[model samples]
Target: MLDKTKRDWWRSVVVYQIYPKSFQDTTGSGTGDLRGIIQRLDYLAQLGIDLIWLSPVFASPQVDNGYDISDYRAIDPMFGSMEDMRELIAQGKKRGIGIMMDLVLNHSSDQHPWFLQASSSRDNPYHDYYVWRDGMPDSPPNDMQAAFGGSAWTWVPQVGQYYFHQFVPQQPDLNWENPALRREIYDMILWWMEQGVEGFRLDVIDQIAKEPDRYITSNGPRLHEFLRELSRETFQKGCLVTVGEAWGADLQRAKQYSAPDGSELSMVFQFEQMMLDQQPGKEKWDLVPLPFVKMKASFARWQQGLHGCGWNSLFLDNHDLPRIVSRWGDDGAYRVQSAKLLATMLHGMQGTPYIYQGEELGMTNVRLPIQDYQDVEIQNFYQKRLGDGYPQEEIMNSIYAKGRDNARTPMQWDDSPNAGFTVGTPWLKVNPNYTAINAQSQLADPDSVFHYYRKLIALRKQYPVFVEGDFALLEAEHPRLFVYRRAWQGEELLVVCNFGGEATPWQLTQEWEDAQVLLSNYPQHPGDLRPWEAKIFYRKNGAAGES
Candidate 1:
C-alpha cells in the first residue's frame, strides 16, 4: 500500500543538499550563511531541483560544522540572524522550491543550556536530559566507543558522573527514555514547522534510542515506537518529508523505519554500500579499493528488497563523505564521463535522487595537506594514526583518499581568487583545479556534466516510470558494467554504466535490440562502450521514447 495521504509528493523529486558554510559566503565573514543561500535560489532553481536540504544552519559552536547544534530555534549569528532565516523561507517559496532543514535531535552540543544545567548538579531537573551514569566513578560506564574515536563516556566531575556521547565529548547524546526530553524535542520540531520549513532531514535519528544495558548503540527495542510517535506528532500533521540517517539499517529494518502506513519516515539512508570501501576494524580514514562485485550485490539487494515494500534514497556522496568522482569514478583522465556515468546509474533507479552541492559540476576530491585540513575527525585520525606508529605520508594519503573535508571544500562557483565562494579569505582552501572545473565553466558549456545532470532531473520529472517503476538487475555478473532495468506500464529504462576505464563490448539482447537512446555521455552509440561511459535507453510498447 502507498502512503495513506497518497501524495506521491517526494517520489520523483530531486533534492540538492547544501553544506551552507561551504556553499557560498556573502557576509564577508568567510562562511556561507542564510543570506548566501537566499541569493543563490535562482541558481538552485536552474538545476531543476524540487527541494533544498540545508545542512544545519541553526545556532552552533562550530565544534562539528553546525552539526553540533547549540540552539534548536535560533539561527546562528555566523550564518545569519533569525530574520534572515525567515527571509530565506519566504524567498525560497517564491522560486518554486521547498526547504528541508537538517534536524540534529540525536545529540546536543555540551554548551547548550540544557546540557550545562544538566551537568551542574545532581539536583538539577535537566540532569536526565542526557544519558548520565554514576557507575565505577573512575572508569567509563561501558565499553562502547564513540563514532569519531575513543571512549564514548566522558567524566563529568561536576555531577560526580560520566555522560555518554556517541560522537565527540562536547556533543552529549540525548536520553530519549525521558518523556519530558522527548516532549521538548517534539516541541522544537513543531516550532520549526510553524516557521514555514517544509521538511527535515533527521540526523542520526536511528541512534536516538540506544539499547538498554549494552555497549553498542542504535536500534533499541523502542526505536519504532519513538519514530512512529514522532511521525504522528510532527510529519503526519502535514505533508512534510522526513528521512533518517540510519548508519547500519538493512532492507528489513528500513521497511519498518519507513513503513507503507507512514508511521515513521519517508525513507532511511543505509550506509552498508557506503562502507563497502572501508577496511573493517580500522578507522574511517583507512581506505581500500571498492569491491565491484560487492558493490553491485549490495545495491541490487536494496533495490530488490525494498521494492513494493518501502522506499530508497539514491545518492553517491554527501557533506560527510569524499567526493563521488574521486572515490568511485576516475578523477583524472575520465573524470567527466565517470561523473556522468555515476549520475545516470543513480537517477535511473527507483528512488529519490539526491544531488550534493558541487556534484553537478563534477567536482572531484581535494588533496589538502595535513596542515591545511579542517575537519575535526580528519585531524583526530591523523594524530591517532601518528601515535600508533603509522608513517606520515601514508596517513596523509589516507586522509586525502577518505577524509570528510574532501567534500567540505568551498563550492567552485567560478575561477576567481577564492573560487567565487567568497570575496574575503575562504574558511577552507578551494580545490586548485577550480579554474578548469567549476560551475561557471560548466554552465557555459553545452556538453557539461551540469547539463547532463539537468537533463536527468528533467527526465525523471517527465516520466512516472522513473518514480514508480519496478527494478531488476540486468546482468548481475557483469564485472565492469552496472546494468539495470526499470519498467512500468510498458515503459522501460535500460541503464548501462561502465564503471572502469577500459573499453568493453556491450550489446543488447535480440528481445531488446530496438531500444533507443534517451541519454548518453558519449555522442555516438559505441559498439564497444568507452571508458567510464553511461547510456540510458528508453523502450516503449513497440518503439523507443527517442529514435
Candidate 2:
C-alpha cells in the first residue's frame, strides 16, 4: 500500500491556464509569443500562482488553433523558437512556478509528416500510423457523425481510403493500436520532460483508445491498459502531475483513473457541471437556464465520490469554454460580487482550482458577429445551423452564450487601444469592457476580483481544510443559497454564497455565529447576506478561534 502521510505537491497548489495566442503579444505580430509570457512572470508570481498550464504552442497548421499539431518536437515560429520556451521554463522556476504543457496525442494535423506519408500510398511504412478504411470515393465504412457536425470519415483519393477524425477533417486520429506509433509518442513526451516541463494536461485523452468501427469513442476496451503502459514509461519515473481531459468520465470512472496507485493519471477533468446549463439529451447549443438544483447535486456527488481515493480538477473557464462570470453569474450590475461569490464557492471545494487568463478580472463574453468568431467549432456549427433554416438571430444568441471564442479574446491588460495585448491589431478583438475591467485597474484596487482570487489561492495553501477536508453540502434544496462545509481534523469551515441578485436571509447555526471570518466579499455580516455575498467562517474544537 502507498504511504498516506506524504501528500503530493499538486494537491495544495493552484494552477493558472494561459491561452498563448490571446495572453499577450510582444512581437506586434497580433499573436502572443513565449517572450510575452516570460515578460509577465512577475504578474503571475504576484497572483500567488504555483503552476502555469499553457495551451499548445507546438508546430501546427493552426486549423484548430495549436491543437492540430504538425510536428511534435518543434515550436511554431508564430509563438517562438525552442530557445524562448527554455527561457520561459527557467524563468517560471525562479518564481516557484512550474510549466504544464497541453499534450494533444489523440490526433495530429494532416500536414504532419507521418500523415503525409500515410496518404501517399497504402504500401508506405507509415501507412498504419493513422486510422484508415478502404471504401469508395463517395462512401465511408461507418455511419458516424463528426463532433463538429458532418461525416466523421474524410475521403482520401490519393490512397483510395477514408480516414477517421473525431474533430475536423484536417485532424486525423492517430492509430494507438500500433506499438510503433505509441513508442514514438512516448519518446516525444520524454524529450519535452527533459527540457524541464513539470507536467502535462492531456487533451481529449479519453478518445485515444477509441474503437471507431464499433461506435465506441471513449473509455474503450484498451483504455486502461494503454494508460498504465504510458504511465509506467513516463510519469512514474518522476514526481510529475498528469491530468487527462475526460469529458465522458463519471464518478466511478474517475475513481479508476485517479486511483493513487500510480497506474493511470493524477486526476481527471470531468464536465458534468459544465453541461448543467444545456438541455438534457441535447447538444450544447440547445441551451437552458442554469440548473441550480442539479448543479448542486452534481458538485456534491463528485466531492463526496472522489474524497478519499480519486481527485478532481475544479474549473469553470478554459480556452474552449465561455467565461463563468458571463455564463453563470451576473456580468452587468453586480459583476464583482457575483464573480467573487463564484470563486469562493469553487475554491472552498476539495480540489485543485484552475484560473483561466482574464477570468480573475471578471472578463465577459463578446457579442461579435458570426464573421468575427475565429474558432473552428463555432464556425462549423454556425454554418450547419444556417443551412438548417435557423434564424440568424437565434444562432447568434447561442453563440453569444456558449461559443468557445468568448474566452479567446485578447487579455484585458489596460484601457489601451488593444487592451495592451498588442501594439498592432489583436488576433481577436478585445472585450470592450476592458475600459472598466483591466488588470491595471484591478491591481491597484484592494477589493477587486483579482485580489479576491489571490486570497482564495493563499487560503488553499495555508489551510489543510481546503485540501484534505471532507465536504458536506448544506441546505441542498435551497434554490438561491449555496451552502457547504469543509471539515478536517478539528478545523471546520462554513462557506455560504447567495447565488442571486436579491438579499437573502440565511439562518446561521450557533456553532458558526462567532466563528472567525476568514474571508468575505462584504465588510461584515449584517444578519443577512447582501446581493451575491459570500463568506467563509473558520472554527476549531467546536468554538470560534483565529484562523
Candidate 3:
C-alpha cells in the first residue's frame, strides 16, 4: 500500500520544469538529452526543489517538439535510451526529488502505429482508436480550425474519411469514446507508474473529451467521467500526483477536477490570469498592456475559490509562454529586482509553485528575424498573417512580444560559448546577454535572483502559514502594487510588492506595524517601496487559533 503521507509530498515542495531540448547538451549534438538532465541532478538538489516536471521525451518525429508522441513507451534516440531515463528517476529519488512525466494523451503523431493502421483501412481494428468522419474530398465535415493553423480535418485517401486533429495535421486526436483506446492508455500509464514515475502532467487533457462535430474543443460533456475513470484505474492506486492542463476551467470547473474527494486530478493549470495581458476575444498575438486591476482580481478569485475546496498551481511563466520578466516585469535596469519581486508575489501564494528553467536566473525574451524562428507555431502564424494581408512589421512585432522561443533558449550555465549549454551549435539561438545572466555568476552572488528564489522556496517549507493560510488580497486596485496577507492559526504573513520601476508610496497595516521582516529584495525598507521592491513580514499571535 502507498503511504498517504508520502503521496502528499507534492503539496509543500516546489517543482522545476525542464524543457529538455534546451536544458543542457552532453553528446555535442546541440540538443539536450536525458543524460544531460542526469548530470544536473545535483544542481537541482542544491536548489531545494522536490520535483522535476520533465517535458515530453518520448519517441517522436519532433514535429511539435515531442508533444506529438509516436510511441508512448520508448525514449527518443535524440534524448537517449530508456536506461538513461531510468537513471534519472533513480538519481532524483536519491536526492529526495520526484520525477513527473509529461503525457500527451489528447492526440498522437500521425506516424504512430495505431494511427498508421487506423488510416490504412476502414475495417482495421484500430480505426476506432482515433476520431474519423466521412466527408467529401472538396470539403471537411465542418469549418473548424486546427490549433496551429489550417483545417482541423485531414482527408485520408485509403480510409476515404477525414480524421480530426486539434493541433497540426501531423497530430490526430484520439477517440476517448472507444473502450479499447481508453484501456490502452490506462495500461500505458500503469506501465510508467510501475517504472517508479511519481506523477504525471497531462498535456491538453481537458481537450480529450472534445466534440469535434459540435465545434467544442474543451469542457465537453463527458470530461469528468473520463477523468474519474483515469483516476480510478491509475492514480488512485497510489499517492501519485496528476495535474491537467486545463485552459477552459473556471472556478467551479476547477473545483470538480481537484476536489479533495480524489476523483479526477490533484490540481489543474488554469490560464485565466495568463490571458489578462492578451486582447479579449482575440489570439495571443493581439497583445495589450497588462491590466493590473484585472490581473489581481483573477489571482484573488483563484486563490479564494480554491482555498479549501480544491487546489491551485501557482506559476508566472512556462515553456509555452514568454519570459515573465520581459512580459510584465522590468527586464532592463531592474531585471534582478523585478524578477525577485515577481517570485515573492507568486511564491507567497498558497499553491504548488512551478519554476520554469532559466527563470531563476532572471532570463529575458530574445529577438530574432522571422526567418530565423524555429517554432512551428510562430512559423505558421507568420505565414497565415502574411497571406491575410497583415503588415510584415506588425506580425514580427507580435512575435517579438509573445514567441515561445523566448523561453526555449538554451540555459546559460556560464559566460562561455553558446551559454555553456552545448559545445557544438545550438538548436536555437542563445540569447545575446547570457554573459551577465548565466547561472555561474548568480550562484556566487548571495543577493542574486537565483539565491532569492532559494530563500523563498525555503520559507515556504519552513512556515505552515504558507501552506494552510487564508489568503486576502490587499490594495486590490493599486495601479503598481500587489499586496496580500496570508494568515494561519496564530500567525500572519504580509507580502508587499512593487510591480513597477518607480518608487511607490505604501504603508503597513496597523496590525503589522511591528512585524519582523522575513525576506526583502532591498537591504533597507524606506517609507515608500523602492523600484520593484518586495518584502514579506511575519507576525505571531499568542492566542490559539487566533486570526
Count of clashing residue pairs in every prediction: 0, 0, 0
lDDT of 1 by residue, 59-94 (tens): 889899998988999999988899998998899888
**TM-score for every candidate vs. truth?**
0.97, 0.97, 0.98
RMSD in order of candidates: 2.7, 2.6, 1.4
**TM-score, candidate number 2:** 0.97
User: Using lDDT as the measure, which candidate wins?
Assistant: 3
lDDT of 2 by residue, 1-547 (tens): 1121333667777889999999999999999999999988999999998889999999999999999999998999999999999999999998988999999999999999999999999999798999999899888999999998889999988989999999999999999999999999998999998998988999999999988889998899999899999988988777788899999998998998898786888898999999989989998999999989889989999999999898989999999899999999999999999999999999999988999999999999999978889998999999999999999999999999999999999999999889999998888888888899999999999999999999998888788889988999998999999899998888898999999899988878886777889999989846778999999988887433432
- Over 351-438, each residue of candidate 3 has an lDDT whose tens digit, in order, gives 8999999999999999998777889999999999999999999999899989999999999999999999999999999999999999
Worst 10 residues of 2 by lDDT: 1-10
Q: Model 2, stretches more than 4 Å misplaced?
A: 1-7, 542-547
